[model samples]
Target: MRPAAPEDEPALDAFFGHVDAEDLRFRFLSAVRKVDHDQLKAMVTIDHDRTEHFLAFDPASGQIIATAMLAADQSFRRAEVAIAVHRDFKRMGISWTLLDHVAEFARWKGILTLESIESRDNHDAIDLERERGWIASACPGDPTSTILRMTL
Candidate 1:
């Protein structure tokens, strides 16, 4: 895994394109048909101190297969974490490792809490978060979604 640079936009776009549709919905909490260039640029043009993006590449193909992002608030006491792994790369422990990495990164930045907002239908991700000791609860007034929180 490595910090995402502006030049990695194309690879990031391709990585998003390679992700499953359902996974995309789970990641964005929307029915995203295609990831636009502007969105890709936003992902790559992060400010490392408050917002960090990381990409995991496939050793054999050298293609990006997973991504993790942590965005902290102005207070820097808490951060929101998000991750997406390519369809072909699922079950390879990519998400697990990325989440772990982001949690450690958040701690190093003095973030006191890490949170993930996920769709209720995303059972696998919820399970994984639970396995990592994240507390899960329903998102307020949103029956279709859930929120997971981990205290650092």
Candidate 2:
């Protein structure tokens, strides 16, 4: 795992495209209305140029299999983490590695907390977040969505 660079955009897109549209919806629900190239770019690289993007690559192929974006708010004391892994790479410990590094980055930066909101229907994701000690909250009238937070 490493910080993403400007040159990593194409690989990032490719990795994202490996997951089906329905998978994306299941993970984010209506919170993410669409997943277009511009949206992917913005989520993966357009924020902080240096340290916010974390990627997992296969050393044998030099191909990124997963990515997590940790973008700090204006205060720089907390961040929102968004993670995505290629469908083929799911359950291979890539998300765990990415999330672990994201926590390490937050610790290094003296951040207070890391937050991730996943759809309630995305049980795998919810379970992952909960296993990491994230506090979960539900969206009113929406049983399919949840907000999770972890103190750094």
Candidate 3:
């Protein structure tokens, strides 16, 4: 796994397609946006001027299977981490790998806390955050979404 690149845009879109539609909606907060190739790239593509994006690939097959983003807010000393695993690799630990990578990056980057904006319906994601000791609370700016935070 490594930082995402411009050339991996297509793979990123394909992998997003591999995840269940409901999972995508849960992560993104809307089922209406199809997340076209351009949008997917913008979502996970690296931009040092802005956010950091990570991609995981199969060692043998060289296939990108999971992706995550850690976007830091300069004024807050906090970062938002988002991750997705291809449905084909759902039970294979890819999501955990992505989370671990993001967590490490957050620590290395001097981020005091990491937050995950999850929908109330996304039990799996909420459970994962709970398992990792993230505190769940109502989103400060948006009441509809639940925010999970963890100290680095």
What TM-scores do the predictions have?
Answer: 0.98, 0.84, 0.90
lDDT of 1 by residue, 1-152 (tens): 89999999989998998999999999889999889988899999988889999999999999999999899999999899999999998998989999999999998999999999999999999999999999999899999999999999
Model 1: runs farther than 4 Å from truth?
none
By TM-score, is 2 or 3 better?
3
Winner on lDDT between 2 and 3 is: 3
Candidate 3 lowest-lDDT run of ten: 41-50
Model 2 segments more than 4 A misplaced: 26-35, 43-51, 140-143
Order by TM-score, highest first:
1, 3, 2
Ranking by lDDT: 1, 3, 2
Provide the lowest-lDDT 10-residue window in model 1. Answer: 33-42
TM-score, structure 1 vs. true: 0.98
lDDT of each: 0.94, 0.76, 0.81
CA RMSD (A), model 3: 1.9
